[model samples]
Each structure stands twice: as C-alpha cells, then as structure tokens.
Target: MRGVLVFDVDGVLVDVTDSYRETIIRTIEHFTSRRVTRDDIQQIKNLGGYNDDWALCKKVIQDFGCHPKYQEIVDHFQRIFLGENSDGLILRERWVARDGLFEQLAKDWRLAIFTGRTRSETRLTLDRFGAQAVFDPLIGNDDVENLKPAPDGLLKICATFPGVEVVYVGDTVDDAKSAGRAGVGFIGVAPQQDSRRAELVELFRQEGARAVVDNINELEQVLK
Candidate 1:
C-alpha cells in the first residue's frame, strides 16, 4: 500500500517568509506603532505553539504592551494578508517545492495537506499552482478544533487512510509535536539560510524527526 504524505503549506510547500511572516511583523507594527523585525518573529516561532498566524500576531502585539481586541487584530491581519480583492502580501508567497516534485511524489504516495491556513487560503495557492487536484483530504485550521501541537489535523488525515503509514512534512516545532502526538513519521524542512535554521533543526531532532532537510526538494531522498 502507498503511504500517505501530508504536507504543511507555509515554509514547507510554500515559502511564506515574505507573506505570512511579513504580515505578522506589519500587523504588529500597525497596532503597536513599533517596528518588528524577522528576528522578533523568529523568537516567537522558536517558542512554538504558534501554528495559527492570527494567534501569533495577537501574542506579539500583547508582548509589545498593546492589548487590542483579538478580532480587531485578526481583521487587520486579514486586510494585509488577503486584502480587499486578493491584492495583498499573500501575493508575495512563492511555492518552494521543486517543479514537478509533487507530481512525482504523488505517483508513489497519496498526497494530502494539513496546514495552518484556512481552507480557502490553502485553496488559493493550490489553485494558483494548478495543483488543486494533487492533494486529497485537505485539512486546514478551520477543519479542527485545535491547531498544531494538538495533533487534531494529523489525526484527521490519519483517520482517512486507515492502517497505512503516514508521514507529515512541516517546518515548525508545533508541526513536529503534532506529528509525534499523532504517531506519524515526521520530516522537517528548515532552510539553511533562515536565521532560525539551526535552532529548528535541533528542535526537530529533539522531537525525534525522521529527517530534517533544508528544503522540500530534498524530501524525496529521505522518503525512500
């Protein structure tokens, strides 16, 4: 039987350093009136439990000593990310997986998505890349009661493919923990140039990750 391969959207299949991460910094500054850098965002991400970018934005805003309404922060984040008619920072996102990589992987493994993005948000990228039909049993933030580190999404995907080996490819500590909790194999993607690369690689090791690659293109070798 073909094993199931589940992937995270941001930093795994898509590079969101300038889209989602940039929105986090921009959103915090918009509310706190103070500049927030990528390093600042990295600090929070390194601490984990921040799979949901909206919640991460709220926490960072509160850390800056501003207590804005959660919904207010979310609205601003959506404005910056999704924009009025999709002309937002989200357009900056670049799919990171190598060309033809997903197609090749799908031949040997059933592909799926378990990402922190809302289902609609995930679909936008899938549709843009013309990969809307590549993944099955897509699970997004809205699909589960709890986010990463809770194993809800991974468990849901696992439930869909009974008795099959399942592996989750992701980039965050929360992702690692979620995979561990779900008793699924985990492969971490942490780019070498990232400021948090070493830290993330180490954390993935601590979580007993099956392998840690600098990018998703290298994942094929590990899967074999």
Candidate 2:
C-alpha cells in the first residue's frame, strides 16, 4: 500500500511564531490587562496538549486569576487575529516548507492535514499558499471533539485512508503522542528558530518520534 502523509499546520507547515503564538500572548494580555511575554506562551506550548490557541488563551486567563466566558474570549481572539479591518492582523507568519514541497510530496504520497486550526482558518491559509488542492481529508479542530494527544484527528485521517501506512509530520510532543496512539509513524519538525530548535528536537526524540528534522524541507529526506 502507498503511504499516507498527515500534517500539522501550525509549526510543521506554517511558521506560527508571529501569528498564532503572538495572538495567544496578546489575547492573554488583552483579557488580563497585563503584559504576557512570548516566553509565557512558550511555557504553555512546551507543556503540550495546547494545539488550540483559543483554549490556551482561556487557560492563561484562568491561570492569571481571571474568569471570562468562553465566547467572549473567542470573539476577542478572532477580532485581533483575523483583524478589525482590511489592514489585517498585526502579526504575520510564513511557510516552513520549501516552495512546491506539498505538490512534490503529493506525487509520491497521499497528503492530508490534521491541525488544531479551525476549518475557516485552514482554508484561508491553504488558499493563501495555493495549497487548497494538495491535501485530502483535511481534519481541522471543528471536525474532532478531542484534539492532539488524544489521537482523534490522527485516527480520523487513518480511517479516511485505511490499509495504508500513515506518517504524521508535526512539531510538538502532543503530535508524537497522537501519532503513537493512532499507530502511525511520526516525523517531528523542530522549531525553525535557533533558540528553541535544539530543545524541541530533544523533546521529540524523547517522545520516540520516528525522526526529527529542523526544517520541513528535510522531511523528504527523512521519509526516504
């Protein structure tokens, strides 16, 4: 059987250091009315099971001794991340994969996405990168009750493409756990930035990832 490749959007494919991560820090600060540093956000991310930024923001707010309704937090987050006007959000992100990487992978393996991003957000990013047609069975947060570390998204992708070896490419410990629970191979992509890369690589290695790479472009070599 041909191999199936499942992807995590945020850290593996798109660099979220500026966009989603910034939004999480800003949202916490916005709700608490106090500054939350990127390090604070990284602390939460490092603990794993925080693929959903909305949920992460809520946790940060609650941890800071504040109580706000979930919908209110979501509204504020969407406003700031998606932006209030045509100018768009203050934060920006870029693709971690090399140009035409997905298309090239699609030629040899079935490509799919299992990400914590919402369907709309995933669509917007895919459209932006001209990758809408590359992946199949894109599983977003809305599609699964339990997210990463629960294996819900990975299992769903496996169910969709059965009788094939599935390899999940992601950047976090949760992603490795999900792939492990779902009985799929995991390739960890360490954070692109230098400061976090070594630590993240060690973390993924500790998780028993099939392989770990510093760049998404290196994924091709790992799979081979």
Which candidate has the highest lDDT of all? 1
After aligning candidate 2 to the native by TM-score, how far in Å is the CA of 104 from where it should be? 2.3
Report, for every candidate in turn, its global Cα lDDT versus the true structure.
Answer: 0.90, 0.82
Pairs that clash in candidate 1: none
lDDT of 1 by residue, 58-176 (tens): 88788878999999999999999988998999899998877799889988999999988889989999999788998998999899998889999999988888899999999989999
TM-score of 2: 0.91
lDDT of 2 by residue, 1-224 (tens): 36889899987778877887777878888889887877767667778878678888999899889999999999988887889772345338687677878777877899989988888889888888788888888999899998788899888877877788999998777888888888889898875554666767777787779898887888778888
Best candidate, TM-score? 1
lDDT of 1 at 57: 89
